[model samples]
Target chain A: MAKPACKNLEEIFRTPHGAVYQCNRANCFWLEFAGGISAFKASDFLHLKKQVEQIDVPEMVQNTARMADIVILNPFRSERCFVLTVTDVLNLRELLQGAKVMLDLNSMLYDCLHAMAV
Target chain B: MKDLLRLRTSLTEEIETLLNEQIKVEAHSSSVYLAMSSWCNRNGFDNSADYFQKQSGEEREHMLKLFGFINDMGGRAISPEVTNIPQEFESFRAVFETALQQEIYVTQQFNRIADRCFKAKDFMSFQFIQWFLKEQIEEEYIARRALELFDVIGEEGTGRWEIDKQVPKIKYEN
Candidate 1:
């Protein structure tokens, strides 16, 4: 018989100060937290995190899902490590679908910003 | 003179300008590919090097196609100014990544040229550029696929080494 999966959400959410929970499963809920801050502020990362949670439902879980692989918290600033889960890794396939969209969007925004500056 | 002929002449001139820009980009692409080939050869990736060497020839062929088209239109074909190619590469992956980037640049250039010709009502030049636009798609695909293969093999895998061995031996007929 298949073993019932244990709920590890609490362990997954636990993190050291100035750090966040990062997921490592093929596809699961994983994210990092700010070090030294109480775990109560988990709501701050809810923006993109909500999109991932939706994938758990059978009807909501499509063959493809767009999820961030490495969530960089204040990526440009400090040693804020990114978290990724197994589900997030699997979701990368969807993110790559029509992969040119992000690249084209970036170039378009860059051109627009440059034009504005000029 | 008929209004159609006058419009045709004006359209041809516009196409000439766009084609000139395209030829310059092609020249740049050829140089970049040659440099990449040389880097691959030096880094024990002879297959990748040979592949880029062929790619350089292909880009030159693309330039020639534009050159011929401009001459056929009775427009003055300007000499393309190609910049110097960089000699050093940090890794094989970097070389292929650069090639992929160049291919994307070339594809965008071709699209711009084709759009300009279309706007000018120069159907002939637009049709000619259509082939080039299609070619760029394939070029980008090949470059991207090469990079993906490199990723699969890893930076120092025997698979990459074996593929490198096949590089010098493989020769394109055209």
Candidate 2:
């Protein structure tokens, strides 16, 4: 089976854990994580990113057994939670890093092009 | 790769949002003072009207100062849209009461901004806001003293008139 190649959707970021897609048409983000997919508003996505980044992984890793503790992301709109282990968090960090870079890139390009046009 | 967000705005997203909120608060305070000025003028409190008019201008100046700082720091400064200004007051005393309340609110907001800057480790903004923190002292003092006129003069019969006459003279020495 082939995954649908969303030619129109912009790939904001991708990682081994998952990928984030920005749908320009809807002005929303499509997050594929942990074998599940969900759509999020830009604000919600940023909030989720902030929450994830704030997780105290290094301290938790040092204090607890790796397999026992988990990070839970309970999306406001959904009943389901995306549970994450320490390793999963590191993967999420990578995904977020990539997305952040792309966002920064897009912003710079827009600024540069606008400056040149002006 | 260039960090566009950081490069274009030294402010963190949270800090920028908070600063913009402060801008709106300042604009609202300015509009509120102008409305108070109008109310005073209508109620025959001519000197008090002048006092409020001056206060409104000062608030506007503060807003513009913050606006200029944000832009100078590479953050996009929003021209705030202010609404919900009161056009009338219960009395002349009430006008001073409201004015005191507004000054206190402004002081609290600056304190909040200072705290945010400290938490974000944005010492530059913290240092910049130090002037505002100091200015609030004078602002609160004048507002408090002006309100005190109602108490000291006793708003009975021509008492409000006397208080109104002295409004312009109510200056914060410190």
| Best candidate according to lDDT | 2
CA deviation > 4 Å runs, candidate 2: A1-12, A15-118
DockQ of each: 0.01, 0.07
Q: Across residues A1-118, which tens digit of lDDT does each residue of candidate 1 receive?
A: 1112434322322212212221222222223332222222212233233333334444335435455323332322233343545444334324322222332343456557779999
In CAPRI terms, where does candidate 2 land? incorrect
lDDT of 2: 0.81
lDDT of 1: 0.58
What is the DockQ score of candidate 1, to 2 decimals? Answer: 0.01
True contacts kept of 2: 0.06
lDDT of the candidates, in the order given: 0.58, 0.81
Error of 2 at B168 (Å): 1.0
Fnat per candidate, as a fraction, reads 0.00, 0.06
Which residue pairs collide in model 2, if any?
none
Q: Runs in model 1 with CA error above 4 Å?
A: A1-118, B1-11, B163-174
Tell me candidate 2's interface RMSD: 7.6
